[model samples]
Target: MDIDRKKSTYLTLGILFMILLSLIRWGGETLQYLFYLRVPLISGALLFMLPIICIYLLPSMLGNLFVLKNKWRMSLVIPGAVATGLGIVIIGGIIGTNAAARFNVSPCPLLEALLQDDALTPYLFALILAFPTAWAAYWSSGPASKEMSNTDRKIGVAIGSILSLLLMGAIYWARTGETVSWVSDMLLMIISILPSEARAGLVKDDQLTPGLVTASAFLAVSTILYLIGLLLYRPKIKKDRWQLPALSYVLGLLLIFSFLFGLLTFVLDYYRVPVLLSFLAVSALAYKLWKVDHYYDIRPTPTEPPKPDDFIGALKERLAHQQGRRTLVVVCASGGGIQAAGWTSMVLTGLQKRLGKDFTQAIGLISSVSGGSVGTLHFLDRFGNEGAPEDSELNAIFNASTEDSLGATGWGLVYPDLWRFSGLPFLHTQPRDRGAAIETDWKSFMKSPNATLRDWVDPIKQGKLPVPVFNATIVEDGRHYLISPMTFATEPLEGLEFNRLYPQHDMDASTAALLSATFPYVTPITRNSEEDDSQSKVTPVFHVADGGFFDNFGIVSAVDWLNEQVLPKRVELEIERVLLVEIRAFPDEEPLQTASRKNVGFLMSLFGPLLTVLAARNSTQAQRNEDIVNDLKTKWTAKDIDIFDFKISFPKNIPFFEIPTQTGYENIDQYTTALKDEKKAYTPPLSWTLTKKQKDAIRNAWEILNQDQSSSVAELEKVWSRK
Candidate 1:
């Protein structure tokens, strides 16, 4: 009765394909009419830069579609891809050219539409870059021009380099204001011209003229990326195959899709649960009718748990090895993109720095979700031997994680990952997924013991480290799914322990870290499988999303561990006080008068129930954790076992202009009150990429914690010094 795991990819991609084409056509023509219809100078520049898009972006990334020897694959792949792209372009042109275009937006009166006569416009835009596009098309079509025309290459470089740089300079000149929002909106306005990018609104999308000219700047970026990939792609394919080459492509594609989807998401909005389920159901019926038993097992297998393992018992033995009773620490890291990463990294390092050698000895567990797990991985890698991270390591993670992930992931979503609909599953022999993209920077930054989740177990059992629980949410049930060497307690929080369920499939540190942090539509849903205990041959696979859905704070597992593992054995293990370190990424939400925040929008009224439930779950989880802490305090008060809950929050971000570049400002307040303008609305966005300023802001922001809200840092330090 279950949809085959492999078939789920098709269902997801099917939804993407259906909505994507229609959305693009409708969005491109709908005319936000906010800007005047102008035949901009830069549209010609984008045409000149066709070498990158036509040759590299399409061919290099997806040219595998035109596989030389594989006739069957070529027959299906090439035509299908072209048909999809071409049909959508035609539909959009027709829609734009004909019919009184619907306007959900009502800011301005209708101006003369550009595509009212798109029949001539398509040829006009194409003719401008005919040579390069033709050259690229010919080379990419088959074995016709394998080496590529050197003259065309030289011409593309010259046109792309000269014009693209000019476009950038023009953008700099065009920025009327000094705010980050201005340039971003300008770029958004520019990108809105792309047929695929309709339905704006990531942040202020009533673009004016000259925004279209910036498309060249965007194309130039892709051109530069293509050239870089062309240079580096060949050498690495031998070792890593598609993984490395696809990374750069993903990066470039990430930039493109971030803007494309950023705009299109306003309408398409990667949230297609109902549509997705419908597709899945229809596909399941078809498969059943055809009597198909799908055995598509190409997804990466989970790593095996260590042999002769008693994780809990091993931990107790190591804790008992310590000379006397000491306060056992539990760290519950919340799931909030890179914000959580920044907060967790700085706070954990600060804890390690404060506790000195006693940090690992005192802390019993580090239970984290999504971005918190990413930060946890880095902390162990950077400070594992050094005791504390250098200021550079703290900031380095922020910069490294920012850009490499977001666009690269979207690239995966847009082009290659979409092929799941065509049933050419073997085409992507290696994974080009958001999870893989997210793993890239973190993997490079980590190694050895901290490199994988499995790597942490021995150190933890040997009395050297705290256990790391990377919390994920089971997609099917929205329960907590802890990805660690040892199984976790998932009772009150309702989590599925991966180690117990799928013991054969161990996790790498990166997947475990991001398993639960996956944002809807942006990050891929991770599918894992296991043999059914009751049935000898039935192996059911489970799809899991980010852990934030169940418990963003990650307190349930930590509390469960304390109640079941530590508190139960407190007397036997000679345990002292329980110091619960809750690292919170967000500032506390101001207490609300009602169960849910009021939103009066029509869309909100229609789609708000599920979202409201999710929101309530989050707020209620926070309250539940507090209640549990209080209950534990009352129940265990007389046991000579004290409970110290130390909660830490990230300091406010300085404005974009206020964030220091290279000049070393150790802390936020150190920047001085005069320089501090308006506070940033959110922590460094929960996206894949980060800017240097954002990273620096996160690091400098780390210094403002005073620990007076709950148990004082001074008292916590006293507890750390207890042994």
Candidate 2:
């Protein structure tokens, strides 16, 4: 049974036992108190709470009746027999008073007159008290006698009987004034303190019992033994030790008794001595066991080597055969910046294949540096919660999932358009759509086969390059390397404003070299709002402090130069030239003409879903949101640091000078008419417009030129012309 059930059962049993004891004592004491002057029932109940009364005497009554099986041995039985004889003496004394004249004997002043006589002196008085009280201690030992073995029980009873008879004989002698002694008085005092004296009502008479000395001695010796036994009876899982069952019962009874009566336990405590001592001893043993085994290696088989795969093909086969409900692809970069893009492509493809086309699944792209712009979108798509990346669960998922040490590769695919194009910091093409960019970058890397450049450029290549790409922006401000794209975008202007910035204002030779070297792969494609309808085609290229593309459009050499020279000197250049720039440009200065490539509004919207998917890759909803926000902000803010918000606008034939100027004198209609006239004047001839075939050839030539040395541009031109 559980502890509750056991406690309930015990509680019921205890209540019943208390009731039974109360009833028996109530009847006996109520009747006695009616005949006597005191309320015996209440007094007996109070006395029962005492150690001598309850702990010892109650059991003695039962032993006397059942175990001893002798009615004559009861103190009440012998006392009743002698009471009739005492009455005869009292009657004779009264008769003597009545017949004082006839018998010539006055009543002995009731019994007091006779007791005052020299014949009934102090010594005799003490003897008289000792005689009846000696039986109290003798009977008190009777209950314990019953618990002994058969042999001990018989001997104890015989000894008890002899002591009882001897005490009774002494009482008879005292009644006749025969046993008068100091020793008897001392013995009487000893007996009165015993449980039997309290049981028999002798102690209540104010009589000094001689058994007090012996009882006190027994109590002292038992207390010492109790302490010692407690010390010895420790809990060990062995035959010689105290068992849990017996100990529980003993402790339980003590607990109940303490609750019922305020059994105050202090320094000289009688309870819990054994339990505490045993607990201490057991604790010591446990400590020793722990010390001995602390360093022991209980674990089996010290080491197990992993089985080596014999054939790579077989391993692949086995891997393919294993059935999994879900598959996870991990990505890792230097700081996990490029990993986001890789994850985006994988997730999109996986979802498309698994769910089919036009599936209404939302994709997210997140950056490690930025918070949860991406993941938040994903959450809205999935669970529809709108908490920011930092405080949201999405952020945690993104951070927790980006473990770079796990052999996951980052997606840093730099496409040709990214390298050749100018303006926006870092490669920005979506991996799924950068076909021309990827093909050109791949050819360049293949043709060059330069390890140093390959390692550096591969990460920036927004193609099928198996390297991680980071979101690095050399904004006009040039200060701290703010890793988060989102924070950089949304972050308040710390040092400089946009209008004061200039890209080529004070360009130095080394700075020029760095810019020239990195311009190819890090170019930002200009997209004129009127000329380009396919706005989605434009991608971001990597830039550096030298105000040039690391890989303009798709030129690997430019990316190599930025990575090798410009990036290494990025910090130095930023410190000296940036200080000069900041000193030169003020927030109020003419806003440096920003390139028109701010088409990020539409591009951002277009790739927003893709970015969200990228963020969600290898992360939960919460993480995806965080990554997207962070990446977006970082890329956006990079404009200030790199200072090259070069707009990717479509090429236009009309020059800035050719456009009509608006003056206060010109009304709205007049200005409109002038612009229309200029437009008509500048209209291109139909013959000059390139054919579809020509455009394709030019595009193909651009791709071939972007390659290093392997693919010939001439060959590409020939094919394009023939097609």
Candidate 3:
């Protein structure tokens, strides 16, 4: 074949490849809307193609600007195409991940939300990304061959310019005929996804007119395309060796900076400070403590030491009489949304039955954060309450079907909308009213009818509950605020200082549980304000967000509370043994090291940093916990402190909603039949049964406690006989 003809054939194939890629990207979204939402197929197809054409033309125009010889230019083609495609995927992933995180939903749900809202900003951002992506592809393709005939080059430029104009014209024509105002539609869509309070001020009334704004935007975009086409017509082939390398360096730097900026913004928006800042603050605190050498004295002095007859003091005396044979059981549950909550309920139910009548009395402390608190709070509320059934009833309440747990009414589907509307500061008549709507529905689903906040607090205060249960939440200052019964105790110790932060506030068990269980964007941030007459302004609003943000499992807070408060006060009873029970929802899976060269994999890698941070934090906490346990074990031998970690694995295919429901015996029977009918489907193991897992965990706990108690008692008897 003639060299020119061969080159033309390759160019044509490249354009066809771009179209195929575009079709795959946008076509999937179009089909989803068409089948699921019943969006007009024609409209969906047309809407989908608009972005495709825009993206497809970008690489074509970029490739045409370069005039290169056969082998070198062809080599550039593959690299350019891959770079552009990968760039789009990576950028989309970053956008989608941030959006999902901000909205507190999964990526698929966030995409659906954007589609339903008809949000244009995401599309516009994609369009904006195309320019740099196209440029990167163009640069990789190498400079146009200076040896090419002028005639052939002119012909290529004319073809490209005409095609670009035609494509732009078609997009504009299709957009203009639409009844929906795309600009205002997009603005409203963006506002809808924002938190309720932020939505009102996002756009002004003047910005609501779609026609003028849309026209202006269309004109600006068309002009930019036209200019780029003009540049392609008169190709500038940089022959200077240094120039291309310098340009590549600049482009790479810009891309890296852009990614870093995005990451910083994401961290700051969610955490109210940069991750680095948080890290530095933690380091500084550690340094300050080290410098003090005797930092324990820095803690506030307690109002008074407890007499032997007082609450904790009496408990200490009882344990002393038992000759250190009493087990100090500390249960630490991790957060994993509603699934974790169900697991917690299962574990607690098993513990209750295993302990028999002494279920409430045997528990030393139940420390939890996020979803785990939901079950812990519920259990504490109903444990010894009148008319509350012991085991099966608890399971029924916690492991209820999704319809029953969330709500049978369709209103549950719009629970997110409630979070949006109810978060508005102006709309809320009272501070509690801010989250009241969503909280009411959530509490209805999760709260135990007999569990009052007082039930959890009263027991701890009166020493009926051995040690106060620790429920943690992250306040505005990015610190863990421990909400325990001791928070309200008359102690002036630093451990109880967090309670003073929200003084006079009635923190019912349900409310505290709700606050601790708040899972970022899923639950609205609870804001409380107080007027400061002296300053002539309301004091800085105190925001209570997710406890998981600070400590997902409450292990850190539990250990801190034990070391700082409980141990110091109990002079007669040293923590001879510590049993840490950790309940995890999923089995430990291998980390991703090598990803497939696919768009989904590329997108997933965008969350690598976030996953790393979470993994590191969990690992650090686990190590710290082990260190505490080891210190006790080394001092009193390995029999002193034992950590019982339980990881309950459910079938990966089981939907999160179904996991909780499947825990109940009736639900299990129904699911089992369903699984049989679909033989290829994953059948959940019998161990996945919530009650069974709970029983297993409790039985394990008992064995550990009994073994330690037996050994300690035997040692005590030996000493007594010798004396």
Which candidate wins on lDDT?
1
| TM value for model 2 | 0.14
Regions more than 4 Å wrong, model 3: 1-311, 314-324, 385-393, 396-435, 445-456, 466-470, 473-475, 488-497, 529-541, 569-576, 589-611, 632-723
238-317: candidate 2 lDDT, tens digit per residue: 31222111111222223222221221111112223443355456555654654311010011122221111111221122
Candidate 3, residues 14-88: lDDT per residue as tens digits? 999987677568734433322222212222232224333322343221222222222333233222222222223
What is the alpha-carbon lDDT of model 3 when measured against the actual structure? Answer: 0.42
TM-score of each: 0.59, 0.14, 0.46
Q: Which ten residues in a row have the lowest lDDT in candidate 3?
A: 292-301
Task: Please give the RMSD to the true structure for each candidate, in Å.
Answer: 17.0, 41.2, 22.4
Per-residue lDDT, model 1, residue 26, is 75
Question: Sorted on lDDT, highest at the top, how do the candidates line up?
Answer: 1, 3, 2
Q: Enumerate residue pairs that collide in model 3.
A: 67-144, 67-145, 68-145, 453-509
Instruction: Report the error of model 1 at residue 621, Å.
Output: 1.5
Q: Please report the TM-score between candidate 1 and the true structure.
A: 0.59
Q: What is the lDDT of residue 699 in candidate 1?
A: 58
